[model samples]
Target: MLSLPATLTQDHARECLEQLTDGLQAEAAQVVVDAAELRQFDSSALAVLLALRRECARAGKHFAVQGLPQRLRDLATLYGIEGLLPAA
Candidate 1:
């Protein structure tokens, strides 16, 4: 599983995405991203999640998010992309 940082703002989004990009290459048939550690973040968090979701889909791997904070869920909902990050 890939863990998100406490702060996932524009300043860290790129690096976060890069890290997740590496995680996606794992040989597992599915990827579970644990988001409980994420406390401080911005819309860029959703961008990172979306990118991971897209990458997983392209690789034919199931993607799920675990321990998503309510605030981040709200952000995903606001962006109308919550469906893509199904709760694990």
Candidate 2:
């Protein structure tokens, strides 16, 4: 499982995506991201996850997020993207 940092805002979005992408390349057919540590975040967090999901799709790997904060999940719902970020 790949772990997200405690804070993931726009300021850290790019860096976080790069790091997670690198890790994703090393994962197996199914990639699971742990988002329990993510305490402070913004819409950028969802962007990063969406980008990661796209990467997973291109690589033919199944992608899911574990322990995503409720608030973030709600944000995804508001954006009509909750279906994109599957829960593990």
Index of the highest-lDDT prediction: 2
Q: Relative to the unseen true structure, what is the C-alpha lDDT of residue 31 in candidate 2, on a scale of 0 to 100?
A: 97
User: Which 10-residue span in candidate 1 carries the lowest summed lDDT?
Assistant: 21-30
lDDT of 1: 0.89
Model 2 misplaced stretches (Cα beyond 4 Å): none
What 10-residue stretch in candidate 2 is worst by lDDT? 21-30
Candidate 1 lands at a TM-score of 0.94
For each candidate in turn, the TM-score is: 0.94, 0.98
Per-candidate total of colliding backbone pairs: 0, 0
Candidate 1's displacement at residue 15, Å, is 0.7
Model 2, C-alpha of 6: deviation from truth (Å): 0.2
Each model's lDDT comes to 0.89, 0.97
- Evaluated at residue 82, the lDDT of candidate 1 is 85
Per-residue lDDT of model 1, residues 1-88, tens digit only: 8889888999999999999989789748888999999999998999999998889989999999999999989888888888988987
